[model samples]
Target: MEYRPYKPVNLTAAGRDYAVAMVRRHRLLETFLVTTLGYSWDQVHDEADRLEHAASQTLIERIDALLGHPDRDPHGDPIPTVEGHTHRPAHAIRLADAAPDIYRIARVSDADPARLNRFSGHGLRPGQTVRVGEREAGELTISLPGNDQAPLVLAPEETKAIWVSPAASAGLRGPASI
Candidate 1:
């Protein structure tokens, strides 16, 4: 038999269903590990990647139920539903290109673990309010909402990896709220 690489489009209905199931399991596990176990967002991906293939469907469902069937993973990526539906935000834009204003960190791509660690160290995470500052020389400045701490300067890649949505009101100066 000639060996061929599998492509997403070539999956049969059953294959697609199984793939989605695995994805849902992986993402749910990632969320559970981070929120319930105190694992950092960047740390859960590898663990989930290892466990997802080994966990049974029953085990995955139990984990999902225990986590209240979370909609988003630790990194703010949407989890595919058992029915294969996803709820991605339509207005999410790259932090680098976002207009200077108040915005909520919607999602941070977990493609780079190092960048993820840096973001977490700077207290940047999903749902946090931030004030977008000036963009210059391929870097973007952002300040925590209402915090006196110095604004964090992020490289274009760093900023681009983050997604944001308009925040009702976030300012460079004000009281900080988690």
Candidate 2:
């Protein structure tokens, strides 16, 4: 968990609570901006980061209610509850690490907007069921559910930014389209 070399930090109970609160605020704001204010998935993260610092608990709760208590944000990240409990699927794995099988995208890293835009262009957003194919030279082959075109090859950086869970539990057995 160390982002810096030779630096280690652990969370105390209160510290954990604070961390969750900040995350909760961030995700809730992202949900609101996308679902209500018409922000694209690629546009909400930094906006949410800024808003999370200024939004009050009451405002976040109201946003949560307004969004009908969304379970996940535009990036497919689990939104923590007001109680600070979050549920990330146990089977969720980075796309690069996924076995060759059908999987529903669960989340994508929000660290880069350019990557997000590229993923969206390739139909790689959360809830999209994709088939993982061969791997070679740090790239993964991916195919959309019903596409007949050549498989899309995701580079290592893209795969590392994407996560997926098995498709059966996606609750999208008969999606209208991919």
Candidate 3:
């Protein structure tokens, strides 16, 4: 147990290993809570935080297996592999900055449960499709694919927490997004 100042970039080998293991446990717990226990994405972050430090490695592994080894957590954050590696998407951009075109909801932040609720109320989720409408007066409008639903309006800050990527034309032809 060494008392060293925190240096995120230049960690010692042992420090880095411990850091990675902790992060892996936290993420796996989040995935498991969401997938197996039906916890919403916004609810898992705090729950994982409380359990990660106390849960044993064996319990974490069992949970991972139960969830079929999910690669992403409920909010679409990558879960570190058993080897501590993470893969990030290359083209994800904030919905606020996305061009006025069709985009698929890639990820939403878990930092704000209220915002997550708002997104859920509008049927926004990862892999769901949305059309980027106009941005005006610090708000962004997005059209959801439904005959009866109106467009969803979000604040700029809320829009920034959402990531989207260009949806494939063929994928958009499905009944949900077409």
Best by lDDT: 2
Better of 2 and 3 by lDDT: 2
lDDT of 1 by residue, 58-161 (tens): 98888888988889998888999878999987778889789887788889999989889989998889888888889889888889855688899988889889
Q: Score candidate 1 by TM-score against the native.
A: 0.85
lDDT assessment of candidate 2: 0.87
Tens digit of per-residue lDDT, candidate 3, span 47-116: 9999999998899899888888887777877888888888766778889888787887878888898888
Candidate-wise lDDT, in order: 0.83, 0.87, 0.81
Tens digits of lDDT, candidate 2, 8-53: 7767788888998898899989989988999988999989989999
Q: Candidate 2, TM-score vs. the true structure?
A: 0.88
Name the lDDT value of residue 174 in candidate 3. Answer: 36
**Per-prediction CA RMSD (Å):** 4.0, 3.5, 3.2
Clashing pairs in 1: none
Per TM-score, the best of the predicted structures is 2
RMSD of 2: 3.5
State the TM-score for model 3.
0.86
